[model samples]
Target: MKIKQYRTQFIQELSPLYDAYEAESFFYLILEEKHNLRQIDVALNHELIFSESEIWVWNSLLAELKKEVPIQYLMGKTNFYGLDFEVNEDVLIPRPETEELVEWIINENLKAQKFKKLKILDIGTGSGCIAISLAKNIPNARVFALDVSKEALKTAKKNSENNKVDVTFIHQSILEIDDLKNDFDIIVSNPPYVRNLEKKEIKNNVLNYEPHLALFVEDTDALIFYRKIAEIAQKNLTENGQLFFEINQYLGEDMKALLEEMNFKNIELKKDIYGNDRMIFCNVSKTS
Candidate 1:
């Protein structure tokens, strides 16, 4: 069968699971990855035909797509912050809101007209997206990333190497770290902020395929990571060091309160492109 016809059948078959646009995009993405055929290539070469094995492989992927596995995981890669990173079930796929978090960190650091070098640590750095993006873009910044799961760290390590960014990947839980080298100019995290009750709010593709360790917090203690990180920020951050978080939209006010109560100065809660409160910024005191 012709590739275009196959793609049309793919969309029709997946229409129950995804919209026409999404299914169409999936068709093209698979075509590109498996056959090196972009949408235009497939369209231009209307006679392009798949071999028996190629057809079998495509059918296998279509079955997985119907199961709602994220396409990034299926392709084992994702583009984020203008860079491509390896992704798998081991790590949560890098997200756009987190890209906004990266933008906030990089742009804020640019505003500092200081003579001192900057150091950054990204807690819960899954896929190394935030840390690698920052390290690649921000010159002369010492970047380190931490994740509790060894499986997640494997993907992050690969991402660091692939992106040619020298990010130190550490296998440790942020909640259990007793001490960290001080004077870090910036600390950022996109930790697990989704509440258990919000499971219904999550898309099927995510809930079914993504790593839960990197997605959920108990509903009663949804801010556990943020609170713990804020406490550590007091001791680990530089004098007036900045802190940033990719936060749960529903808990922005609560995060602000946690930082404020910890005596974090200059606390600012900002919304993402969608006008939902998504990232939080604050600075710790030099002396307290």
Candidate 2:
């Protein structure tokens, strides 16, 4: 079948579930991923037809799309902060808002003079996206990432190798670390911030497919990770060390308050591109 004809069928099949344009775009993305053929390539090389086996493979992918499986998961990779990462059901898809979080950290900490080496820790580093991007962008930073799941860390370790950046991947829950590393100049996390009560607001595609361990917190204890992290940050972060988070948009004030109470000084909350209060920043106290 021609590229155009296959796309038409793909769209027709998916239109009931998704919009026409999204279905068409997803069709093209799948082609690019599976066949290494872009939209223009498909147009110019109409004679470049799929072999019988290739058609079978394409048909299988089409069936998965019909189930609303994420294309990133289907391809087993995603681009985050301009780097390709291996992703699966084991890890969360890195979002653009998380890119904003990376930007905030890079822009906030970049210093020109000595090319100072900074030690940074990323807690709940699902895909190692935060730690890897920081290590890549901040030349002198030594980075470490911790994830509760060994399987997710395996993916993150592969991403670190694929990206040619050095990040120490640790398999441990943040809540389990008792002694402070006490070496990091900065600490950051994009932890579980979604309250379970807000699950109704979640779209079906994400709610059904993405990893829930990376997404949800009990409504009554919405600040559980933040509070625990802040407590640990007090002991681990360098004096005047900066702490950053891509936050639950609804809990900005609460997050700030929690940090301040935990003795994180100079706390500030920032909004994402959508104008939602979705990021929080603070610094370690210099004195009692």
TM-score of each: 0.96, 0.95
Per-residue CA lDDT of model 2 for 220-276, tens digit only, reads 999888888888888888888889988999888888788767777778899999999
| TM-score for candidate 2, residues paired by index | 0.95
Candidate 1 residue 282 Cα shift, in angstroms, is 0.5
Alpha carbon lDDT of each predicted model: 0.89, 0.87
- Candidate number achieving the greatest lDDT relative to the actual structure: 1
Please state the error at residue 235 of candidate 2 in Å: 0.6
Clashing pairs in 1: none
Q: What is the lDDT of candidate 2?
A: 0.87
